[model samples]
Target chain A: MAEIRLEQVRKAYGGVVAVHGVDLTIRDGEFVVFLGPSGCGKSTTLRMIAGLEEVTSGTIRIGARDVTELEPKDRNIAMVFQNYALYPHKTIYDNLAFGLRMRKMDPAEIDVRVKKAARMLGLEDFLARKPKQLSGGQMQRVALGRALVREPDVFLLDEPLSNLDAKLRVRMREEIARLHQDVGTSMVYVTHDQVEAMTLANRIVIMRDGHVQQIGAPLEVYDRPANLFVAGFIGSPEMNLIEGRIEGADFVAGNLRVALPPGVQASGEVVLGIRPEHLALTTEADGVAFTVRVIEQLGAQTLCVGEAGGERMRILVDRVDSWSPGQSVGVRFPAAKLHLFAKSSGQRVETAKP
Target chain B: MSSKATIYGFLFVGLAVTLALIVAPAVYAVSLSFYQMDSFVGAPKWVGFANYVAVLQAPEFWRALLNGAIYALGSIVFQVILGIGFALVLNEAFPGRNLVRGLSILPYLLPTVVVILTFKWMVDGGIGIVTKAVEAMGLPPINWFESPGAAMASTILVSVWMWTPFVTTCFLAALQTVPQSLYEAARVDGTTAVQRFFHITLPMLKPILTVVVLLRAIWMFNKFDVIWLLTRGGPVGATENLAILSYRHAFNLFDIGGGAAIATISFALLSVAVLIYFWVFPLEDD
Candidate 1:
């Protein structure tokens, strides 16, 4: 295992910059995931690290070697593409043995490694089958096995599970997590799915518009997002950001007003960020009133989309709290859970501890 | 039910047209091989298998068949190799790639007669630019059409030059359909450039390669225009092929039965070759 360091790496296509200067250090055996929406340059950064794309600027070092100018084959890295990218014409055994053969390994040793990988992936019975004969999940396994057989220093996965169905994606995700644990190799994974990042990454690098927005542990990034983008991107059902003005001691928008958390500095226009789960239905008089537009009952938790303070907001509540559409309810945002951001820049506004 | 019937009715008309235009002529030609008709006006005398026996016994016919094989095989080998090589190069991303691709297809689009005439002028023994250039390079002036081997080689060379682009275009189109991710994966797998071509590119191109080779083989085997225009089976029948021989027999020698027999033999040989090809290289993946 080796640490991967990117010193202000940047990539551009013609005049269009796809990845801005990104400086990151992934420690040995650490599983760092780059998470963002499409066209956010997360995949581009991953490919650059794999040496599949040339770094237009800055340097990338894997272990003690600078691989900035190296070809992908010379980088001593293995990557699993989004589509599995298995050789369709070759059998599973050949696909797994391909890298070993390319390295000029002995035939006996190649066979041994191929068998081991196949056994690990439960593909022994399908060793002679071509990729076309395999199911989506089986193909994914072959892809993972191909990388596993290489025994490279760093493993790069470029949205490898994106092509599978929902149930298969979850299974493959779990398999990848177990594989990382078993191999203990430094891996850099890129995906637009936040859930995958939240579950798989030891440290999550949230990106937006070719820029790294936040880098922190999954819970840390979830609990304390760096900005408006991270706050909205990290969580499912999304964080609710209600635009309003901060008066003397109260935040007011439209016909709604709620007391700000103590010592929350700055006034004028601000966006109040609160996770859906942080908002609660209450009968208190100090709560903001909401008109529920739609109710989505998701078994364990019920999500309600509603209008609060003249802005659309999502509130996640326990399934026990039954609220129908058109119901007018009072929602409370506890002081500890409130996230306030400057409206003009979307940067977080620090609040003093109470 | 009515719509289905209408579709079948349209299909029936198409089948009838194909049978009348294509199948009928082929059948009539094969039948004519069994007759001794000299001209269209005279009644055909039943000759049984005498015409077929004559064609098989004729040393000129056998020599012509051998020349045809050599031309077809020679042209096909060069065409496929250069086609795939050019295709691989053109598939790479470069500036003005579309313009290059458009220009590369010009050879395949030019009329066969024009290509033949152009090649004849360039390879003309006297006052030809190519001959003069070769002499300037300190090489003896080469006769492109006079000697038997030289004539066959020039015919093959010109055929390859004109048709390689067609194969290239076919391969280039097929190459585009191969997913780029496969190459990226192979590269990451530590495959060198040569290995990538053999393992990834070649295998992915197998189905299309087989089809192009089969089509070019058939077309080259039956080709008459290029040979007729360039050498006209000249220099003592050096470049004579089955198609040219059949034409000579029918038009020049006026041996209608013998010409029909030769044509029928060419068709039979081609059918056997196609059958063997299919049997040896079954297209279906294992």
Candidate 2:
């Protein structure tokens, strides 16, 4: 296994820059996921590391070798494309053996590796089957198997599960996590889906507009997002960012004013970030008053969207709680769970007692 | 009336037109091949298998069949090779690609007579560009049409020149259908450019290649106009294909029965060739 490093790597098509200078180092055997919305340069960064795209500037080093100018095959890296990209004409065995054959490995060794990958992927019965003959999940495994048989230092997967259905995606996600564990190879996966990033990545690199928003462990980024974008992007249903100002231990926005947690500092325009699960529906009088707009019952839990301080805040409640639209409710944010960001730059602001 | 019945009523009209225009003439030609008929007028006399026997015995008929085979083979070989080469080059992105592709297809769009006449003028011995160039190169001011082998080569060359664009167009469309990601994947998998073409491009183009070859083979087998317009099946019948031979039997000799017999025999031979081709390169499982 080798550590992959990129120092100020950039990509441009003519005058339009797709990826700015990006510097990152993926530790040995680390599963790093580049997560972002569409056109955020995450895939471009992954492609650069795979040597599929040329870096406009700076150096890319895999272990001790500077592979910025090398071809993908010469980089000793394997990539699974979004479409799976299984050779439609070749059988599963041939597809798995393709990279090995390209490297001129011995036929016996190729057979052993191919069979081992097939057995691991549960594709033993599909050795002779063509890609078109396999289902979506099976094809995904074949793609994974093709990459696995290469035994490369780093494995690059570009949205490998986006093409599968919901149930299949979850299943494949777990399978990929298991494979990563079994192989213990360094992996760099790219996806727009946060669930895949959170579930599969040891460290998630969240990007937006050709810039890295944040990079940390899944829950680390979730609990303490680096900026407003990271705060809004890392959670489902999104975190509630209420634009307001902090004045003398009170946070005010529109007609609502709530007491701030003690030891909080920096008084000026700030945005309060609170996740849905962090808010609780309570009848306490000191809680922020809200008018419920909608309630979504989700089996064990229920989600309520309510208007609080002229902003829509979503709160997760128990399914047993009977809440209707237009009902008045008091929502409380735990003092430790409040995230404050500077309104001017959207950067996270630290609030600690001096 | 119900919608189903209305749809069937419209389809019945189409079927009737096809039967009258295509099937009826084929049936008439088959029936006429077994009888001796005169173009001038009179009832055709039933000759049983005599017309077939006479055609088989004729030396000119055998020579014409050989010429036809060579012509078709020569044209197809050059057409497929040059067609694929040109299509691959044109498929790449470059400045003025649309204009180049449009110009390349001009030969296919031009009237067959125009292309034939142009080639005839260019290859004429006197005041001909090709003949002049040959003389300038210290070669003989040779007769392009008077020589047997030269006439056959010339006709085949002209056929390839006029129809290669059609093959290129078909191949270009087929090449476009191959996803770009497949090539990217192959590159990552360590396939060289040549290996990618042979392994991915060629296999992906198999279905189109089969259809193109099959259609071009059938068309070139019975091709008449280009050969007739260029050499008139002449230079001692060196360029006389089965289509020209049948036409001459019908018109020059006014033996309609003999012409029909040759046509029927050519049809049978072409069918066998097509069948063999399909057997050798079966279509992929759907």
Candidate 3:
């Protein structure tokens, strides 16, 4: 196992820049997920680390060796592509044994290791089957088996589960997380799906455009995002960001003003972010009244869509509550749960904990 | 008769005439092969397989069969291999690629008569540029059309030159179908360039390669025009193939039965190839 480090890594294709000056350090045996919107350069960053892409101008270190100039083989990294690129002509055994065969490992040893990997991936029965004959989930496991048999210093996965159905994706996600636990090898996974990032990663790196938005523990970034983009990107329903202004010590969005705690420095133009689940409907003082637009009943929980003042919002209301469209209701969330950021730059404005 | 009945009667008459124009000739030739020269007015004597036996035993017919096999083997192999090599080079990003591709097709697109005439001019006696170049290089000048061996070699060369680009076009289109991601995947797995070509590119091209090779083989086997212009079954029948042999027997020999017999044999050879093709690459399970 080895720690991977990137120092000001910049990748540009002719005139277009894909990854702009990224600096990150992934610890030994750490499961780091690079999560972002599509074309956000997170996959590019991961590929650069795996030595699949050259650093336009930067250095990458795996353990103590600077592997920036080395080939992918010399870098001792294994990568699973998005489409599970198992060799279509080769059997599952050959697919898993390909990297080892290139190294000319002992045949018996290769057999043992390949079988062990197959056993772990539940693909022992499929060793003789071709990739085309396998299901999407089985092919995904074969891809994982190919990576596992390598025993590399770092494992890189590029949206490995995007091809599978929802249930299969969940199963594969857990299988991957468990594989990491057993192998104890450092991993860098890239995906646009934030839920996968939250469930599987020890630390998540959020990106937008060509810049790194934030990097921290999944829960830590959720609780305290470094910027508005990170906060909006890390959550599923996507954090609701409304344009607002700093009026005296409070931030005001249209008719709603969130009164700031004492001694808090306010920016001129700011944006307010609050998770839908954090906001609740209650007949309490300081709660805002909203007109219901739509009620989506999700069995035990209901997702209510409404307009608070002129701002449209979706709230996750617990328990079965009947609320018709155009009905007036009061909604409130803890004041500290509200996230504040500068409107121009979208940088988070630090605030006291709730 | 009703209007519809009249139209139907006219359509049947037209269909009969079209069939007579195309299908009647083959049937007439086969029937003629069985009859001897005695039936010039009514129906000739029924020889029954004697013509087939005589044509099969002829030395000229056997030589033509041998020449036909060599031509098909030589031209198809050279065309496919060279065509694929050129297509691979063209598939890459390079300066002047469009110009190179356009220039490469010049030989394939040239008319058969023009190609044959150019070769003939380049290899004519001592005045020919090729003959002169051979003499200058201290090599004996080849009697291209006079010597059976030399004539066959030249015919093969011209045929390959004329058809190679056609095979290249098929290969180029097939090469485009190989997904770029497969190559990337192989690269990441430490597969060398050669390994990637063999293991990935080659397998992906199997279905297309089979089609190109089979079609080229069939077409090259029946080729005649260029060989006729270049050698005309030269110096002891060195360059005679089945097509040329059949034409000569029908015209020069004035033996329609013999000509039809040779044509039947040629047809049998092609039919055998088609059968083997089906056996070797049957739809999917194979």
DockQ of 3: 0.50
lDDT accuracy of residue A302 in candidate 3: 82
Give the RMSD in angstroms, all C-alphas superposed, for model 2: 1.6
What is the lDDT, from 0 to 100, of the residue A112 in candidate 3? 97
Per-residue lDDT tens digits for candidate 3, residues A93-147, read 9999988998889999999999999999999999998988999999999998998
How would you order the candidates by TM-score, starting with the best? 2, 1, 3
lDDT tens digits by residue: candidate 1, B43-89:
99889899899989989999999889999999999999999999998
Stronger candidate by TM-score (2 vs 3) = 2
The superposed Cα distance between candidate 1 and the true structure at residue A150, in angstroms, equals: 0.9
- Summarize candidate 3's per-residue lDDT along B70-98 as a digit string, tens digits: 98899888998898898999889899999
Which ranges in model 2 have alpha carbons more than 4 Å from their true place? A352-354, B2-5
Best by DockQ: 1
Calculate candidate 3's fnat. Answer: 0.50
Give the per-residue lDDT of model 2 (tens digit) for A209-270: 88888989998898889999999998887898999999899778897676778877668999
Ordering by lDDT: 2, 1, 3
Candidate 1 stretches greater than 4 Å from native: A309-311, A320-322, A352-354, B1-5
A best-first ranking of the candidates according to their DockQ comes to 1, 2, 3
Model 3 segments more than 4 A misplaced: A284-286, B1-25, B37-44, B125-140, B283-286
